[model samples]
Target: MTDEPLADLALSRSSLDRVALERRRSEVLSELLEDPRTRVAEIRGDRMQVVDPGDRAAPTAPGAPSAAKASGQDASRACSAGALGLVLRAPQPEDRERLVLHLGRDGDGTAYVGVVSPGPHEDPAQPGWLTLRQAGEALTRRDAGLFTTGLALANWHATHRFCPRCGAPTEPTEGGWVRRCEREGSDHYPRTDPAVIMSVVDPDDRLLLGRGAHWPEGRFSVLAGFVEPGESFEAAVAREVAEEVGITIDAARYLGNQPWPFPSSVMIGFAATTRQTELTVDPVEMAEARWVTRGEYRDLLREGTVRTPSGISIAKRIIEHWLGDTVESVTGGTSPRW
Candidate 1:
């Protein structure tokens, strides 16, 4: 059978094809870098700049219009989502950015990558760094795709600078996609941990949301956990729910997934059904667990007591899907799906 309906999760849409063969050729990557048509998305720390376009939607108060509806700008902005504050015009090689990678080509066949470079921003002013979480929904499909891929590559480069097998530092290779150890002659590719986040529903259709021990007060969303070695995505869903909330999931179905590149992980979303409604929250895993009906979920949102995940997250999408309506997000923005 076909997979369950997918949700409109952020960082899910991409316009690049990641020309793998071209990236393999150092000469080709270098040539592309020098091409005047090529563009770069600059990443500093975890933030990228959203290209500010005239007539673009102005940044609104966090709780103003739904962040989802914040679209409807110039066609150029939509086509070049990468232009969000983070994208840079064509730069000469002298920029000498520390980290760079070949992302892929856009619909117009213009190649784009990410880099650490200078921009129009005057030292953290109006056009400053936008966190990926904050910018994902606001970005064009191309921009979101480029940012997520670039961030994941950049984060890997930052952390995997050392060879694990030998006590030696590795160097970036393969267009910033692989790390090779001089001592061991080993190649390490970027790592993406597979995580499962699920919306668990009981017979009454109440959605299961839990607050992690460290999450802010009243914050709750669906349960999520990393996939263990040798565990399938479906199995991980069942195991995580049981481990976190002591509920036995009777059936699990695949939904969709999004790349959560906060540090490199793909969140596989699922909708699950569980017979056991009783929650025995694991002190080590979560602070509290509750099954909230649609009415109660709306009431909690109305009372400003419950906070859900951001509009861009898969958790928020699944939760909204199950709630059968767009519950006012605590983040004060409309979800991208609506």
Candidate 2:
């Protein structure tokens, strides 16, 4: 396995420069829009349009096991032509008034655009609208960056149409990078909520996993919670672990982070050591909490008694890191029903 840096975590790398200054120029923006080499990732709701290469649009099965697979050739084979399938097309006629985001250039120097289409209807079959969760693992690194950036920007636009300062409707500017309020003259940028997710380990080398109140019975994952207004990531991790499972932890070691913008959140990963092995799971946040040896955890995964976040999620990445190797079923197959 290649030594992948934590920053290169799934949905992390991007070739885009985000050229904020250039986004302010109308002529420059118009030129990019007219460029035939520019590809537009049409984001509607939580899904973005990713051109399929031969295969039909396979929206990830809701309950399918996380699709975390190897990157490079493995990821390429998983999704046909992955990035090659993403063909740039001319903007549709009605897309004129919609938000347009600048995603920057690819390695080949082809510009990428992200078009935001907000409405009541989101048809997965209408074309390339694939959920980030469904298509994320198979996407090439550059494509991951493009798709995720687009989705994040689009999601922010959908929810923040009005200014929080003055309650006035905002107008899209800076190539859809910012929204300007007419009443307050304030510029609103995209918002990303920072959330900390951690793998809590005991002195016995056992890993802590928990089932959320709303999760399925057999599913369990590492403890995670959003960072409050005045809390740091480490503080949030400790507080969340304590509140959810009543476990006091030591220092939080930063692992990595992934952009999880189903509605906008950056999942920061950490490895936290806990002196308290006893679990007092909060019934409101989590249904149960337990510690398991690596072997037991592997067996539970193989037996279909437990499930973690998707392969593309940082949660699974942190878990695999703690296991000292990737955790796969003994059969080397994905459990779609889990």
Model 2 lDDT per residue over 1-338, tens place = 12343645767866567677777886665787666556666666776545444542322332233223232333323522244233345555455667788887755767778877657655545444456676677676777888788888887887889999989999888887889998989999988899999988898989999988988887888888999998999999989998998889987888878888777899998888988888888999988888999889778878877776776688877878877666554426664222
TM-score of each predicted structure versus truth: 0.85, 0.86
The stretch of ten residues in a row with the least summed lDDT in candidate 2 is 62-71
What Cα-based lDDT does every candidate model obtain?
0.74, 0.73
Best by TM-score: 2
Tens-digit lDDT string for candidate 1 (110-193)? 988787543433443324456677667667778888888998998888888899888699987777788999888899999999
RMSD in order of candidates: 6.6, 6.1
- Candidate 2 clash pair list: 66-310, 68-311
